[model samples]
Target chain A: MAFTKGAGPHQRGLTIGVDIGGTKVAAGVVTPAGRVLARVRTETPHKSKSPKVVEDTIAGVVEELRRDYTVGAVGVGAAGFVDDQRATVLFAPHLAWRNEPLRDALKARLDLPVVVENDANAAAWAEMCAGAGRNADDVIVVNLGTGIGGAVVIGGVLRRGRHGLGGEFGHMTIVPDGHRCECGNRGCWEQYASGNALTREARELTQAESPVARGLAQAVGGDPALITGPLVTELAQKGDRACAELLEDAGTWLGIGLANLAAAFDPELFIIGGGVSEAGDLLLEPARKAFRRTLTGRGYRPEAEIVAAALGNEAGLIGAADLARDALPRWRQGRRQRRLSRSRESRRAF
Target chain B: MAFTKGAGPHQRGLTIGVDIGGTKVAAGVVTPAGRVLARVRTETPHKSKSPKVVEDTIAGVVEELRRDYTVGAVGVGAAGFVDDQRATVLFAPHLAWRNEPLRDALKARLDLPVVVENDANAAAWAEMCAGAGRNADDVIVVNLGTGIGGAVVIGGVLRRGRHGLGGEFGHMTIVPDGHRCECGNRGCWEQYASGNALTREARELTQAESPVARGLAQAVGGDPALITGPLVTELAQKGDRACAELLEDAGTWLGIGLANLAAAFDPELFIIGGGVSEAGDLLLEPARKAFRRTLTGRGYRPEAEIVAAALGNEAGLIGAADLARDALPRWRQGRRQRRLSRSRESRRAF
Candidate 1:
């Protein structure tokens, strides 16, 4: 870990950001400039069916990072619905968390000021502050992973909506009774436009033993189950016609969904992030074409620019740390006020 | 005109609100409580092919209203894209308004403070302040008319988006390649769920002379051309199963779109307004059911309440008047400052 020394007065101390995903817990000591000084990673105890186990895992990573660098606070980005107060995880689909007070639990164990946020929101904030959305005040960050995750930023503020469930763009129905989603709905946008969609279509083609999918079949050794989103993307990047066509199909779906978002949000820009975005223009070109064709009042209105996110997978942790840093002054002031009130009460009792 | 005598200090004076539509121009003198004190209606000069004709019509209505009531300012709610500054009509599909400086034109002609806004945005602001969305902090108003129009209010402020074109919900593509829309898009939500959709379907059924169309055909005197959205709604209200089925289908589409909005906005309430909304439970019951079924994180998240709008057609004008009133103080101060600056410049010249 190479630490950038003397990060100016405003930059102050470092903060640790933990990204708690369904499969792994990744933590990093992030500077004010969104640079990571040190990092630690561990597998999520999702199989344990204990929220405490996940909390313990997050604490362990923070402790590991803190051993080397003195951090001011910890920010945890969980892949779940976080409360507006950013104190509890309301529910996580792949984790054993049901109304879990993760922030309080982590703060108690780590003995530091902590903030909790939805992973998508964290990533969006990171992008807005340091990446592709740096100059845009109104942006929508779309994360094209297994399923789609989204965060909306308007007027430079992250909009969590009334219930902190805003920006669940993937679940918006694109086709009526089209494809059944894991969320028990039919025709979700993600079912057609996400990484899962990309891989699912490729796998189905290979499974059918289609001549068009021969290259993909041979790459995965004729095992359809071995086909993955990244494998298809890699093949496409290597100039595989079949893989490129599949990506084009997904890109088309992606554009249609983005046009729908434009109607609803009319954002200035859309930052496309997540793992699948690594395909770059191979994915964005088709999406952009579809968006232009499908956008409402295309010529009459200023169309929002759709671009790839600059930050990689580390955006979530970086944003979480930045958010925690932004909240630090208030958190410290609150703690000081509480201590003063407690002392006054004790004096009165004496 | 019945004036509530001795209104409180805060409710001093009256303001005029003008609603410009494709077919008609409606203006009203509104009290601070969102009440219409007086009204005047005239056909829109859409055939003139001149933006000045529309401005003249707006000015004529304001002058007529001013004769009966002493209005301090005027607000015009145009059915087009209003700029973020509320000064220009960027575009109106129905009217000859392309980059029309409507506010300055109206201000010059009427010699009163003027504010121009999107009609749907004006209606949404009205609902948020004094109608169905009253007491709600976050609201989305869906106007189900010939086509759907929408406005979003978040944290009690109307969000007009980066380019003041945020709520074009009618144009969002619902079906991949279903119905062709007049807006040059295929499968727009309005093509499936709006007033035009209802009438078009009813006309199709009647034109095909199907057994299910007998009742509707008889009602429209065996002419499919006479079929209208309101006619079908009325028949459905009188217990016409075929007409009821049509409304139910439209309602289902409405609910699905609402569910999609919930995923993106998570507003506290969705106030349904416009012509088709008069169908009441005939349209809303099925829509609510579809919304509940299609909403993402259905069991975990708080669902926004979908309800009929409180104010009727007068909502646009009422909201416009209220918005004008809200901007009155600032407008007055600006004029005063300008006058002061002008006098200072003259003194310096002397």
Candidate 2:
């Protein structure tokens, strides 16, 4: 096995990064540290949705960017799960792929190296590398979009868990017998904290003609259907009572869920991202207050800072590229086979 | 800082282990691989009454055991919340130790190398070293005793959270508006799946004169006060319907709780210990079944093995001593005051 040296003036000054979203395929040429040198995007074709075409689209984007900048190995970050090998998109919810050999196929077709990874994991890494989580050894990312997303990095190494299916922060059971979750569970943390859930709560409040809904009703033209996550965040920023309450509710739930996560995984910082986080202090102020209130041993331990994600939408691409740059010898997401050491004990404390 | 080597020929013969329980203190000389050599027991004395007298009583038991065997370093597992320094007991519900420097105090008094640890973490380490969790890198210990005790081991090392409060599994809310817990939280995991809960449910069944409570009432002589976690387990083993049903209910909840932990930490093995674990397969069978049913990704990943714990009562002492054998470096648990490494740029993954 050969190891490629990272970030040297040896060859090119650019690395190819691919961000495979639910609706579009975006690719960019990233600098050694993390700046986007050049970007190219294309509509994700809706053909047989042949996994082949998806690979081709990624190659096409990289190919176009390479024409403008000298690109090295490629990194692709997709919405669904990526296998441990860091070269396969094992399953994608919005994309048509099942146990698909993405990186290997791309490597074979393009004669260039490639790696694939989960979008959230990639995004978190990007934040750590050059964004909000920089200089932190332990960091957590909570993406509050359509659904909530979570990722953890401990001692600077991303904890991929036993299987790639490790960091499902959205699915944590927060409310018992409260709301039915999509994953066949009841009252998941996401059901109470995600952007979709925020909209749901806002709609309910508007339908009931609550006292705080007047400002929100004026913005949405008296239609409850107009109350979306983005609109609510907009109204909250403008100091609408109903919108502020919805954001506060989201923040409180987010805080409690985060505290629970902190109890399990002792992270030092949390980077909040996604569409819902655009309200900034409107969402963050309540999140910070409630996190302290619900935290175990509240005043004892050093608290994890809850901050906004710095890299914004570009994290997934950068993280994917970085993951590819450091693929393990036998790396498969769930099947990370380590040489089982028989207790060669060390007093390595944490 | 000096560290002890892994158990080799040196610790093969015998090492004294001490468990400071709520009601009693148990001590014994144990072999490296986990067999008790010479054992002694005494009632756990109250400190308010006479803290020095209680210390003297502990010393008497230690001296009694020392007379029969060549013991190595001593390990004491206390039932309480330990501090990050590992030398102090912050707060113990059953014992009178508030910010008390336990290890150093005991070491000075006993004139023996002493190590002190939280009882649950110690029990977990004992299980990993000599019991059900052998050869596992990540493990979770669920002790279903009076309340609930939890311990998490990641990469074969005990994961002490930011405040030395990593495994507070018992306190996580399983139900938002359920029963009130002793910790001032409602519907904690302990409230539904522990020895106390088991006994409560069994006693209720017997009092209700239900079909499953027939054997339980007979065993307890139709007296509700006679019902206990152990008696219920015993009756369940004897094929009693009501008692068995109660254990099964508790075990199913245990499985659900275990599943939640598994989802959060992604451990490869779960070792179930404590007094209630004595119910054996009568409880474990149901727990295993429920865990499989409720696990997040049922058919996606490798299922974690749920098994019984080893070391029995002496596990806590053995594990604590073993932890002491490998001394904790002060820096491991503290924030490093160092800047970014000069070699970090070179170590970057492009």
Candidate 3:
């Protein structure tokens, strides 16, 4: 419970943030201003069937960060559905976690308060606090990674939904029966708008040996398998027409989905983040145009601004750490209640 | 400023609820419990270019109701967007209300406090207060009428969005490059799952002179132009397989959109209201089945319950009356402030 405090809200002391992604486990000692003072990284035990292996990895990183920073609380952002209580990982598609008590496990290891959050929610919090959505109260953060992930913040509070399963924007069907999603649905927004979509289209072009894809094929040494979302973005940035067109296609899908979001939420702003957003204007310009063309009540309504995320990859860890700090008092109170109940039970046993 | 007050929240005094639709103007003297004690209806001046005609019609209904009951406030539920201030009708698609000062006009005509709200929002408030969504803190009410309209209530408060333009759910795209919508967008959800969609399909079937549509064609005396949404519902309820199948198709599309809504809002319950909901389980059973199959994270997440709306068509007026009563205090305060400012200006002139 030993935590430092600064003059302003954004200048509060340190907390360790652990971001558990499908491929990597990244941790950082983040300040209240969303700055990472210290960091550590390791591969995730993504293939492990036991949840304990993933827990151990997270504990290792926290322990390493805690050695130097006197952190108050730890926040672990995971790539899955975190329960409403922010304690358990209900189910993770990319990891071996099903109803895993992630917060308690990490708290027991670190001897400090801990909170579990959906990675996208964590990223959105970062954007709301210190990144693209800084001044906006009602904002939506869409993470365009391997698959799309998203979060909604309304009236300056994150809406986690009745079951902490809200903001699964990527899974919304854009085209019925079009492209099959990993979630078993067809024509999901992510299937057409995420980094996966960009990489898939680039590979398809190179595989077809289309004359238009010569630049992309040469960049990948004529091997379609070598093509990735980042590689496509790089070529697009270097003025490769085929690669640029692929990004535009994904961006158009992105805009269409955003328009749908506009109809549903009517948010003030949309912050686009993750790997695909690195393409900058190449991805966002088409998205904005499509959003304008597709939005309902287009002429009558004030359109929400679509902007690239400011915090980039560090948003997950930064937001996680900040959220843990914010929840420290509540976590402490819960701990005290649990301890009191335990003592009462011991007395009864006597 | 005269108003009635009752003992309980649900037993508040009388208010007049006016529902302004594209074709009709329905008004009722409603109780706090959402019961309509007295009612009135007239065809809307939908073709008139003058906003004053609609206001005058609403005034006529209020004056008629005043003869029997001493109502406290008046609430108008219009078919399009109401501003966040609850004072203006920003832009209504079905009426001649472009940035119309609806509340002021109604207040002036009736000599009472008035509040204007989106008809869908008003219906949702009614459902949340005394109908299907009673006791649910977070609920989404989707009105499947000529086109879909929706409202979101979270933590028992209606979320009107930053611009009061939220919950335009029908405009959300369900198909890419699919049916063109009157809103100048293609593939809107309403194009697939609303009463208009149902009527259009039924008409198309009969117009094609297909054997399957023989029952429907005969019902309308071989004239497809005479076919309407209610007629189709009546046919389906009477055990017509073709009509039932059409409803099932719309139901499936309804469920897909609901799944998308679940992904975004994660409400505990969904109350399906409006004209199309009159078909009951014939429409809802298929929708529920499709919702279960198409929901994101499927078995891993808690699915929202989809049920037919209570209070039927009267929901819009009932909800409006209740909301007006709730907002009475604030309206009075605003009036007092304006009066004080006016008097002060007169004093300065003297």
Candidate 4:
């Protein structure tokens, strides 16, 4: 197996990073320093129940990229739970994958080493390494996409839980018996603090054809489900008073949840990313206010900075490729060392 | 500095550990193995505003125990925020201590090395070393006292946060705009799941003169304010249905908060300690049930064990002394090494 400490001037080999979303597969040939040197995009075979079609699409993307660049390894960040070994996709709600060994399959087919990771974890790592969370030992990345996805880093190490299921921030039950969530729970933080929440609130108001939501209702032809988070964000950014107000309300909920996170993790920095965070201060201003107001022992402790992710939508692709290039070898080495030590102890016992 | 890796047969020196609570000061001479050789207790000079009064009381207890054992060092676990250096008490709500240099003052007067720590951190360390969390690399100790207190260890290192205020678990907001908390927030976890919360519920029931609280009201002579957490625990243990129901409520809240924690830290074990934990499974069973139900991605992740602390109330004193004997020197050495490396780097630049 190829081993490199990190990105060095002489060892700047390229790696392919693939982000498999619900609708599309976005692939990029990322430089060792996390720069996307080249890119490719293809629609996901979403209708296929078989995992083969999706794997084939990923392999095709890698082969297409391999034609242009001498890639070392491939990192695929899936919107689902990745196992601790970074070798399997345990589950993906939108994709036709469950307990899928995507890494080994891709490795065998593409003839390149592969690593898999949860998309949010990849994004957070990108921010920590080459974006807003640079130089901070502890960081939390709140990816405010369709749902409020999260990733945590403590003491410069990603804190994947005992079963590699840590950073499920969106599903944390913030309010008991409150709003119903898709995850069979009530009052989950995401239910009240995400893109879907913002759209849901705005869409609800449009049903009344109220003066505040008149423009939104017209834009979506009076269909509440047709309203997207980005449309609301665009409307808010264009100085639409009602959309801004809606964003403010969602931001406040975001801030309250962030305060709860502050009380628990005490991170040095919080990087806000994803489609919703693109609204910038429209979403963050109220969040900042709520975070300060709700933070426990606010006056006594130093407050962590809440900033937008610098890498934008490219975070997952960049972070995944970098992890494949840098972290994968070290992780494999550590696992081998543990296994070797255990065998040595067992031999001594005999 | 006398440096020791950890407790071992070769380093069998005794240390004096003092636990300064709101009502009293408890002191103990503890061996390297965490055995309390001699114990002392004294009423706190609560009325005295002078720091000297408390310092003198602590010294008196140490002197009394010194007559019985040959001690090497002293450790004091203050029921408040200890600075990152573990040398000063920043601000204790219950005690008259604000930026008090307790370690230096004790070291000067006692002529022995002294280490100070947050009482909850001390207890958690004790549990990690000698009790329920023994052999666990990652652990979370939820100390349920008047309010909730917390300590976390991850990857074999105590997570003290960037500002030495990491384990403030009591303040995590579970209910948005619910009950008003003393921390100027509404619906803090401690407001719902603590000894104070238990007593407050019982008192409110007594105020209504309800049939359910009739036995508890009679236990305190009908004076609701006179009802303490221990009194309620005793009543519940003796088969008071109302008191047991109250405990169940608190346990449920505790479990919800634990689930939230699992989303964040995901430790392998959670050692429940402090005075209220003495109720054992009466409090824990409900907590465990709630923990499983509320846990995010429950079936997908490994459940952390929720066990009672074995060292009991003596945890604070014993842990503090052991930390003084073992962790202090290592911490000091680390600081010294960092300082040396920084200076060396600067010198090399010239």
Q: Candidates' TM-scores? A: 0.92, 0.85, 0.91, 0.89
What are the per-residue Cα lDDT tens digits for candidate 1 across A1-350? 24668642234557889998878889998886777888898898865578988887888899898877877889999988988778898889889888999988888887899999999999998898779987777789999999999998776767888878888899999988888999899999999989999999999999999999999999999999999999999999988899999999999999999999998888889999998899999999999999999998888889999999998989999989877874577543222112223323432111
The interface root-mean-square deviations, each candidate in sequence, come to 11.3, 3.6, 11.5, 8.2
Better of 2 and 3 by DockQ: 3
Which regions of candidate 2 deviate over 4 angstroms? A1-14, A42-48, A209-211, A298-303, A328-347, B1-14, B47-60, B68-72, B207-214, B328-350
Error of 1 at A106 (Å): 1.8
Q: What would the per-residue lDDT of candidate 4 be over residues B1-350, giving only the tens digit for each residue?
A: 12235533223467888998888888987766667767899998884468888899999999998876777789998888777778888878777888899999999999989989889888887777667776675678999998888897765556676556778899888988878887899999999888999889989999899999999999999899999999989999999999999999999999988988887777788889988898898999999999999887667557898999999888999788877774345433211112223323432111
Off by over 4 Å in 3: A1-13, A330-350, B1-12, B330-350
Whole-model Cα lDDT of every candidate shown, in order: 0.85, 0.72, 0.85, 0.80
- Candidates, DockQ: 0.38, 0.31, 0.36, 0.30
Model 3: what is its DockQ?
0.36
lDDT tens string, model 3, A7-88?
Answer: 2223336688889898989899876666777789999995665898888889899888877767788988999988888999
DockQ score, prediction 1: 0.38
Per-residue lDDT for B247-274 in model 1, tens only? 9999999999999999988888999999
Q: Which residue pairs in candidate 4 have backbone atoms (N, alpha carbon, C) closer than 3 angstroms, thus clashing?
A: none
- Interface RMSD value for candidate 4, one decimal? 8.2
Worst 10 residues of 4 chain B by lDDT: B332-341
Each model's fnat? 0.73, 0.34, 0.73, 0.50
Candidate 3 vs candidate 4: which has greater DockQ? 3
> Cα deviation of B86 in candidate 4 (Å)?
2.5
Predicted candidate 2 versus true structure: per-residue lDDT over A80-101, tens digit per residue: 6565566666667677887888
Give the per-residue Cα lDDT of candidate 3 at A65. 80
